[model samples]
Target: MHIAEGYLPPLHAVAWTAASAPFVVHGVRVLTREVREHPESTLLLGASGAFTFVLSALKIPSVTGSCSHPTGTGLGAILFRPPVMAVLGTITLLFQALLLAHGGLTTLGANVFSMAVVGPWVGYGLYRLVRRLGLPLMVAVFAGAFAADLSTYCVTSVQLALAFPDPGSGVPGALAKFGGIFAVTQIPLAVSEGLLTVLVMRLLSQSSAGELIRLGVFARGNARQDGQQGDEQGQDRQRKRVA
Candidate 1:
């Protein structure tokens, strides 16, 4: 979902940069708190960065003459926290631009704003909301992934509308054209991403990595902690009987 260089006008670029500044600052502050709270978790955050990098690097051709890649921000947000996902996403996009030419340096700020800031926040927010509502883990994962994809496209549409306000036609016409083309590719991609995210979350929930549940990674309720406590109590009872 990289908007090629020159697609956005100078005014739009400046606007996006200005709008994204607060998010960047907030993300940094959040990451700092996380580092202080759980210093060892930094290792996991770095691993998340690598995971995002790999996920974004793999592309699938779409019908819009462009390609789509897994954002992976939902997974990262679920694992480390949304702010950590933002940092990792920025790093991954920078590396992609410099090394693979997947996106342009000039449009890096815009790209970061849309994909990293908008997408991850949307996904993470939805995940948190659903978890609070006691939804199933898989359902939350799907919702998060779907929101992330749709938010990215909405950002893209805004960027396009701002850039080409009047391509001989009105702003509405331009937006329609841009949204139409993007929607064609984004719809199927969103569905695929939703399914994949649900599957991965389910797998993680079942694996030894289920410690993620304790860390508030998945959208599971506090029941996981209660269950762990109950199991510990049962184990203690068994030990007492043996003694």
Candidate 2:
């Protein structure tokens, strides 16, 4: 669900922009490091951005008179890393705003904070947690997707509430209204995202995509190797520069 421009008050927009600045900065730093350490990651990040843009543009009408689309962050996080997913998400949002008018330019930062930042981080964290608990791949995927979708909605609702805090409405009322309205569409959306993510992960696991393995996008322990390689490469670069 893209929050259109002017939907949020100026104060709310300013606050969200301020809050999201650090995330954007951190994401850029992480991406830059990844790119420097593993040049091939740049291609994967571009692919993630293209995939996310397409997914977000394909929308279906939901209960709130607004259309909903897949976030695609789960897929990126499953394939790349969460921080990289944030960059992909930012690109996707920018394209959506420029081409499709799905989201507004003024509110791009806020929307990115909710969908790209909050959604992927929550989903990736849940995936890690469920996998750690020794759950099935499908279960982990479902949990991650569901949590991601729900968290995005929750964040959007809070943003809205902050912008338009009804004098007569309490937190419960806001929650009910936002939760109820979103749950109708988001539940099914989450299920769809979960299935898609699981299928993609399964395919990648079976394929000979060494890049995916190197990125730690599918296999659980593979990420350690990726990180180790990154670290070693960084050290080698430093040594060469010193020499």
Candidate 3:
């Protein structure tokens, strides 16, 4: 499912754990605030972690022997933001490492850094960027989900490449090799993941619209404001040209 037990260099593993520690701290604080202030959010946050665990555990085999799967972190990030996702995703990885024999403790840090940190942040940022650029909600979610899944594999490939570079071609070559192998499995899953997430969100929009609204999931405040400003600038430019 991942780099496997003891596959990564000890120094690299330690470094990644160190790097991810602060984000974990921040995430715990954010999650605690949500639980304390909005008690209902506890269920949602726990659901997010459970969702991540289930999706991530369903690994599809790749040609390179490493498995690929939907991270489900993108949806969580979109719902709760990336910082909160940091906590949920870390817990999910920890459970998988202990129970599933899917990944290993030695590589938990690297796994957390890739799946928990980078994937969610990239997905959340992409969703915000596209929404601000005026893409519709579903479209932005689709982009984010697809990109996040692929990006997780991208990071894992880089980590592996860094640890074991090709003798003749170095890290780049190894990176490409790893990426290509993983991409075959990952690309289709990326698309499927995007579709599934959008479908689920559509259902949630109908059933739990109020909850989502309260959570700011449907609040397009920044995107709407930015979009209006852009439109106004465009209109001004057109008027100036006509004048």
Cα lDDT tens digits, model 3, 121-229, are 9998999999889888889999998888878889999999998899989999999999989787788778877887887676565455445666688754543332222
lDDT of 1 by residue, 1-243 (tens): 887766677777777767766777777788878889989878877777788898776665554557678777666666666666667777888888888877676687788898888888898899879878987767788988888887888788878776777658777877888889878778888777777777666545444234665566633565354233225465465446445
Please give the CA lDDT of all the candidate structures.
Answer: 0.74, 0.72, 0.79
lDDT of 2 by residue, 177-217 (tens): 77788777787777666766665555444442355555655
In terms of lDDT, which candidate is stronger, 1 or 2? 1
| Lowest summed lDDT window (length 10), candidate 1 | 223-232
Clashing pairs in 1: none
Cand. 2 TM to true fold:
0.81
Candidate 1: C-alpha lDDT: 0.74
Tell me the lDDT of model 3 at 22. 87
